[model samples]
Target chain A: MSVLAFIDQSEGQVKKGAYEALSYAVKLASQLGTTAEAVVLGKLTDDIAALGKYGVKKIYHVADEQLNHLDAQVFADVIAQVARAAGAKIIVLSNNSDGKAIAPGLSVKLKAGLVSGAVALPDTGNGFTVKKSVFSGKAFAHVAIKTDIKIIALNPNSFSITEAGGGNAEVSAFAAAVNTPKVKVTAVNKVKGDVPLGEAEVVVSGGRGLKGPENWGMIEELAKLLGAATACSRPVADTHWRPHHEHVGQTGLAIAPNLYIAIGISGAIQHLAGVNRSKTIVVINKDPEAPFFKAADYGIVGDAFEVVPGIIEEVKKLKGVA
Target chain B: MKILVCISKSPDTTAKIAFTDNNTKFATDGVQWIINPYDEWYALVKAIEIKEKDPSAVIHLVTVGGADVEPVIRKALALGGDEAIRINADTPDSYYVACQIAETAKQGSYDLVLAGKETIDHNSASIGGMLAELLELPYVSLATKLELNGNTVLITREIEGGEESCEVNTPVVVSCQKGMAEARIPNMRGIMAARTKPLKVVEPVAADSFTGIVSFELPPAKAGVKLIPADNPAELVRVLHEEAKVI
Candidate 1:
């Protein structure tokens, strides 16, 4: 009985959340007195064996090019088969879009009890209970999975990543019958950018206070300097100050990163509902009483035009750039 | 196109969160219940848009809650849903709720299932995924934009670091969030039409529950905001490093 983690990949590269999930699965496996193993569903350019540094002992790779693009039904069926083959009592996945899409189906297929958005390690003294945020991060509930097979989707950045001396994991190819999805892709729309928000450890988000689309360059600059993704408040996107794709809120994207920097945002309750799970928050605004400051771990009361440039400069300095 | 839009009754977004009975359950007293905002803003609006594109399209509002939630169901009907179904039971768990919904969807033979990414009350974003699984349908969550052409549905969803676009066949499940569309209020004509619309209540089929919530509690109160002098931004950084240890 081992812990099985699904390592998500895109375009033959491992996604950042996969690393976080691997780290988390390692801890969960240790607690369960078992080993951690990974299951990859697509062709990957990255060295799968080197993932052993994340503490997984073995990797099961399904290197079919057809599996590259996520087809939830096919992916879930294949993952359920892999979980059964590996004797994974506990299956872990990163609670991002793809995981959310497939987990419930996989759970039902495997008759496994699932806990999504798990924030902490399970309490195993009595029954196997995991804690998860409820009410949009306003509360928490301890859910005890009664099924023999259990599934957990860990929130991004909830667990710290630790690397140690590694074993080059043994990799074996597994083949399963694939189901062709009824949905066929006629065209692909890719948002060209340096980093995707879901993969960024650092994120810089702007709000209405940025004023207009033209001023967005500074936010982007800061994000580029920190190697982070750029995001926006709902109003900013609604007003077309930023693309709708960049919006984040209760009704938008829910992101939890290692460091989240909010600029010119008032921290509306709705907006806070989405990102309060971030490990560390920094707010920059000229308004001293912006609601975002209350939740921010660090605050700078200055105009974005002035403060954001300062931040960009500081990051460059930290990186040993002139 | 047939769209099944799922709505849940949750406390208004600004309500102060509190628990009852030694923190075992959420306190409902004096709390104003509203349509789960995400559903109101995203799912319902998108459904309305689909109906607009095809006047012959049917939109049904579905909920799994006690009878007290009927008014919300009627409100959804007013907001352009052609009919409503209330599964008469408390949504005890994600599994139970998904089973009830999947059973209803199967019987109705709906072409599409729409829901909010998560209910603001429990914040468990599992029902859509669970229902999709139970029905053996494709599922997408946090969809900001959706377009349907022939039998294929194109959806754009928000992910952690970026957005993903996928094309899936009809009979798929989608959970909506902010960018799907702006919420629309019922005009007088729609409001009047809703009173005449049928709202059918049915008993939920029994299903095995694999998990239970032991208790619920509010997050610890945030510490009082610490203020640093506006002129001393450098000192604020110092406090972040030494006091908050967040830098």
Candidate 2:
């Protein structure tokens, strides 16, 4: 009878993507003629009641320290119980790492129709259908969930956030049976970067054209000035020019940043598969026939050493940085 | 050691996407299908590597599809799987597919189950988790690196901004991505041997699907590239700031 949004938090802080999911649920609840509620695991540093501005009427907090690290089965079990208790006909989540792992297990547990990587709002005029990106953002699929309960994992940066005025949610503690983890986390290795690629608005990606790893100073400078994430093509990752996490291609992380700048990387179809969703693409390759130029919103055919520094200077001037 | 690898075929990465029958079905007129990259390049490769290291290890391939999927299964065998199993059914629902695989694995008693993180076609990325639930086994999604030991495995999976290393006992399910293993092409000898390998066809278990596709549509095509002359780097930045408002 209600909509529930799983507002994922990390290190006791609500992520930016969760705000989009919460806001998305708020709109979905209004359309369904019901109120929206939110669920979070572990204690949070952010004030839970302040989330009411996103249209959540109640906040269900499961304060479990063990829940800090994401365990897919444990989360799925706990969320399924919350959904059943709240009568959540529609469950909303960000199509993120946690969401991707937990939503599928949850779908089986709740027998709910799940649509992940949803790009837009559902079209409910005739029947409930959610539009999602398929073929790695090459196409769209309109899926109709026939089950009584539904789950949606919305893609991050696809929807804008909306806030409601003078709204406050009541926070209450909820208890659910926790399961013993089947997998044990032995070590955590953090990838150090200026910005987390998943949440970055702008991304500057390089390919093998940078020649070698030592010549990456310009790309880093540009990325630092723009506050953008740094990515690389698959070959670069394979050749050890960059870490595997920074590789952005069909076989790598699929990102939809607002602006994606590709340098020296031929826009191979495989490479484009992961980044084609970027709002704007700028290609910097000396090869006029490089495949990436065809998909770029803007193209510059020149030497990376020459063109990148000039662009960096302009960006620095624009930022008024000494 | 026993390993079960799930393989699926999908359109080539560069294939143009189109839908027919009012978007109810995918267009397959001229599309060239290949084993999903994750399956071929990571899950299957890692399985074969383990088999090569331990000659006693057995690797099996499974797929749930019609006769058209046999060629793909044969290809998996060509890559050195001991045998292959085809569940005679076709459904896009990941849970239904997982149920069939779970029932098969329950009987086979596989020590490890590996599948692509997701197929390039539907991109569901759900079967591994669902299968784990059905079989009551531990599950790991998007495992980039896996190292097998006596009865336990060390796993590395990508998190939001880092890598997470996990340890799980045998009878675990893992959906693999890149960094697990390099894809190996089938040699002439392997291809010849694959033609005679055992391919067992089994009837699928009854599993109901929860979702259905209403239709399919392609995204609006790009307007093509707007070329900015190489000499005018400043102008490109100006446009990015003024027109695109991206800066």
Candidate 3:
């Protein structure tokens, strides 16, 4: 039995999280003495065969226009069918919005044990136990799935994507009955920005300590220099200093990125709950006793107005810009 | 327009997490539990808004927890839910919790199911999606705004960079987040009314066999903060580059 990975795509291109999931699945497949395969839903223009560079031996392309937009029920149905057809022992998916919507559905349909927010590869020696973050990254829990079929949704940026040379994979069409979804696409409000948070490896977040809405330009400047997405503390959003959409906390968006830079933010437990999964946290604040420093891998105690522009200048210097 | 809001009892937001019995289990000693703040702020509030819009509409609260969690369930009832259901089991895992909630929702025939994007305890935002799958219903997450037009529900969800709007037919599951609605405290009248509200306790149906937790451990304590004087911002940059290596 081989491992099957669900590759998430949007607007005809595969997302970065998809690559991370692919990388993770390949490692898991190796541990299990099997090859990893990928299943891509919807009509994609991207060369599916190129994905083999990520270690998948085969790519199953279900080029259906009906599968273009995500309907969790329909997606789950298609994935469950693909898993059964491939006789997959383990299924891997990225624990992003789409994966979170579909993986659990597929698990229930397949009666498979599922572990979401998996931070590490499974221990496959005696039993299939996976390590995952619990309590919003405050703790870790190792869970052993005692099922024939298992499903894992890897957190974004949790695994490193490695590329190898010259892998030409076979692409096959997965023929399954497509069900018309009850949900209809109304409108997609795309946030116009330099980077999407889920796809961005680096993220820069600010909090109320930035003081007011006018000072946000520096944070944006730094993020643009780094090609990162921007986020804010809940209080920033609460006070209308920033839009609610930018809030990142236990009650807001949960993001896992390679590098998270939190500026002028006192890391409240709620805020940490949302972003603690980030691979590395760099916190900048003038308050030396801020709770965020307790969770940050790197801490800089300084005022935001002074520190932000300095960092921005350094990033520009690194990029050899005037 | 019957809405069922699912709530989970979690540790207070400020609780200091620790392990017990040689780190094999979560230490619960002297820890105070509260209604998951997110659930209270988003899911329950949105449900109350719907109920207010249509006065005849009923909001039901559902949870999978032990007898001790009834106070929290009552607290939800006090918020505005007309009735409540306690699944009489500690939430063992996401799958188990989702299955039990799905079973109850199926029996109740509720038109809508609302939940917080994720429980503050496990932070596994998998339940609403899993429940929708189990019940063969549409699932929408991180919904900031929701409007119902007949049998169709319009939801706007906050994505990574932007938001997406979708229309789903009835019998759908939606996970609520901030900006959906403002949370309200229980007034004296509401609290008194909650005493007479029907709270049914049901045993969970046997869930599909699954994983068991081997152990739990806290993340390593962060190192002491490095103080860089505010006047010399360049020094902070140097520390980030040479010492911290984050820049």
Give DockQ for candidates 1 onward, in order.
0.55, 0.73, 0.64
Categorize the docking of model 3.
medium
Per-residue accuracy of model 2 over B7-94 as CA lDDT, tens digit each = 8888888888888998888899999888999999999999998987899999989999999988888988888899999999987688
The true-versus-predicted C-alpha distance at residue A91 of model 2, in Å, is: 1.0
Residue A7, candidate 1: alpha-carbon lDDT:
96
Q: Pick the candidate with the highest TM-score.
A: 2
TM-score of each: 0.94, 0.97, 0.95
What order do candidates take by TM-score, descending? 2, 3, 1
- Which residue pairs in model 2 clash with each other? A267-A292
Candidate 2: Cα lDDT at A297? 90
**What's the CA error at residue B11 for candidate 1, in Å?**
1.8
Tens-digit lDDT string for candidate 3 (A1-322): 9999999887778877898899998988888789899999998878899998888888887777888888888999988888889989999999887887788788888988888889899988878898888787678888888889999998877788887554777889889788987777667767765688766778899998988999999988888887788899988998989888777777667778767899989999889987887767888888888989888876778788877787787778776878
Q: Write the per-residue lDDT of candidate 1 for residues B40-129, one digit (tens) a residue.
A: 889998999998999989998899999899888887888888899999987767888899999889988988999998888677788888
